[model samples]
Target chain A: MELANIENLLEKYFEATTTVQEEQELQAYFSQDNVAPHLQEYQPMFQCFTNLKAETSTRNVPLQPRKNYLKWISVAAVFVLTTSLFINEWNKQRQAEEAFEYFKTTMALVSQSFNSGASHINYLTQFEETTNKIFKTENN
Target chain B: MKQADFLHTVLPFKDKLYRLAKRLLVSNEEAEDATQEVLMKLWSKKSKIEAYNNVEAFAMTMTKNYCLDKLKSKQAGNLKLVHSNYKDENTSLQKEVELRDSVSFVHEIMEELPEQQKIIIQLRDVEQYDFEEIAKVVDMNPTAIRVALSRARKYIRQELIKKHNYGVS
Candidate 1:
């Protein structure tokens, strides 16, 4: 690229009007060993950017340890919840069976009481029949 | 988003995130802390990360806000202002010393810049972000961002030239 173009690009660069390509051209020009004397002062400005970009933190990102623990905690919670639900279901089934058994016994007791009451009514009817026959013989 | 997806999509820009944090916070340890804090916050909200148009811009904004808030807090005293991190290992010893000195000078001038310009310079020059991206991160319009960036570059150039002519010669 011509020095004139670089100069124009540099102006556009400082004005924040350069496209990324033009800025890259400027960066390319400055990065070289043979920069023109007039443009030497601006070298450090872009060089500083390169230097800053090179700076990196070696620290490892601690991602999801707490989240991992939370994951396990949720799994455990779900397991506990399901187990409790199952137990509740079993308890309900057992209660229903007990209720059915109690209901059956009560029904049997009610039927026995009804049968005894019907037998007593039948004996009263037989006695009434015997008294009516005795009155008929007296009248004769 | 899944953990792997979040990592693939976002972790590559960690350095850019770190650079922005360092630019604002000015301390290596604090910047690292800020970066990690921002990443963790992003990770926590990974489910919603897909909702953002640009996760990197959102992350940059978070780092900016966090560093600014840190500066306003009691820990503001911890702010180191500016420290030179540039070291050219391939150069001669004398050139290295000279480079370090010039870098120190630049850091001094950078510390003198207003916070907005300082951030703009970092985003534009160091991170190489476009004006549109910077507008999103800084919450300024594109034209305003361009103007602010130009003003910043002009100020730095003037100061650097002044330092070069007077300090070197």
Candidate 2:
């Protein structure tokens, strides 16, 4: 192929306007053992493309059962976390009910003590008055 | 789709996916990770894979997205540079060294390109994607992709020539 024709094809190749056959021709032209000196810079690019194409096969990385395994793990974790949170909340509510009952009982006892103390104070005051009157009469 | 069927359909495009990832991430290990991630994503969404007009193009786009995500994460983490100099033992010494250096130079210069231009080069040169397919993959007009690719190639050539002269000096 004339240099002009090759150049034209190259332009088409870059433009992505070349037909498959023309692309194959360009690849073949570039892959030749001898490339025109002026096109040396493009040789590496062409060689890189061919090399990359050649390397494009399934690489055997020991399949670790898909990394989406982490997604499943995270889902399980969320389930566990939610269940634990619910259980904790339930326990907290139960404890609060018990504490409230205890507080109510303690308040009832405190009210009873206050009423008994008031009666005792009244009794002591009357006793003091009676003793004072008896002493006054004895002195007279 | 069954796992076997999904694997069968996508296995053929592994290299294409890898090349796209490699070009974007510029590291074999990262590219490998990105390829696996892309394949896993395709497998998970296999029901939608059939909807795609071109499976390879779809996979390439997925690979590019995965690589970009990986790159962003790496940047955020402030990780060591993801260099593209994975040397193959099968290549001859002289050619291998030259190609390695050239690839490194190209990769560095590629960083200076706009994201669209870099992606266009990756699609055209690395993944061997046609302009129309690339336009679909990138959602760009085909003519715009061509212009971006042309500019990217010119920039690479200029950078390479400058580097060559700099080394000689």
Candidate 3:
């Protein structure tokens, strides 16, 4: 608090070399109502700082929880939609497998019935060949 | 972050945010809007806010950026940097500012300074942020911040001295 110390600190202050503690010391020195005669000029700067700090917002808008609700709702909706799509995809795959089984059965039955009809046509061709042989023998 | 937790941690610095925005934007309404906008932005980023070591500093930077962008926008060109006590920058050297009577004389000096120095003074002297923290807000190195801060302090000191000597006679 001596004059010499104040001057030294003020010198550091202007150089921006003062530590926070040193700056606080200077702030404390100027804040006193009865400052030294020589230091009166520097008093107002710190005083202005104090006054600036005093000014605050008249209305502080509290953080709204509604934001969280909306965010969570969107997130939840997305989750549900994705889950439903996944289940639908899974169901489609199962239905395809079942429909493939039914198709295989129907295709197998059609192939078996077509094979029988083909055998009857083979027998008719054999009978036609035997009748041709008989006609040739009679002509000879 | 929880709502109650936000009120405890981030909301504590609302006044600081308001003051910073006020210093940058120079209009109470704009500053108010900036502060609210920053807070709301922070509110949504509550999950990420916890990752920051110093949320207040982060918020300060947000306010600074928001105000700067607001100033650069076309409509805010009319908004003065500070109280319009200073019409002419040249008169500050010759004019005798009544310092003791008006604490706002400091603000007048502030208005005349280059934008960077004005902000450095606000962050360092008024807001009392540490040098590193100021560096983060201003996007400058700490050494650069210190130099700017010193230069700003010196300018204000010289101006105050001039006014003081002028008043004495």
Q: After superposition, how far is residue A60 of candidate 2 from its true place, in Å?
A: 3.2
Q: lDDT at A79 for candidate 2?
A: 100
In order, the first chain's TM-score in every candidate is: 0.51, 0.44, 0.48
Model 2 per-residue lDDT tens digits across residues B94-131: 87666556654565677677766777777677656677
User: What 10-residue stretch in candidate 3 chain B is worst by lDDT?
Assistant: B93-102
TM-score of each prediction: 0.70, 0.64, 0.69
Model 1: per-residue lDDT, tens digit, B1-169?
7777878987789988888888777778888989999999998888899899899899989989998888777365764445455455689988867765766667667767877888888888877888888888899998988998899889889988988888763
Question: What are the clashing pairs of model 3?
Answer: none
Encode model 3's per-residue lDDT on B1-169: one tens digit a residue.
Answer: 6888887886678999998887777778777888899988888888898799989889988888887788777356774454442345344544535333545676767767877887888877887888887888889998888899899999988888888778633
Q: What are the per-model C-alpha RMSD values against the true structure?
A: 8.6, 6.9, 7.3
| Fraction of native contacts under 8 Å reproduced by each candidate | 0.62, 0.30, 0.72
TM-score of chain B of each: 0.83, 0.77, 0.80
Best by TM-score: 1
- Candidates by lDDT, descending order: 1, 3, 2
Q: Stretches of candidate 2 above 4 Å error? A: A10-23, A61-140, B82-115, B163-169
Locate the minimum summed-lDDT window of 10 residues in model 3 chain A: A59-68
Cα lDDT for residue B110, model 3? 76
Weakest ten-residue segment in model 1 chain B by summed lDDT: B79-88
Interface CA root-mean-square deviation for model 3: 1.4
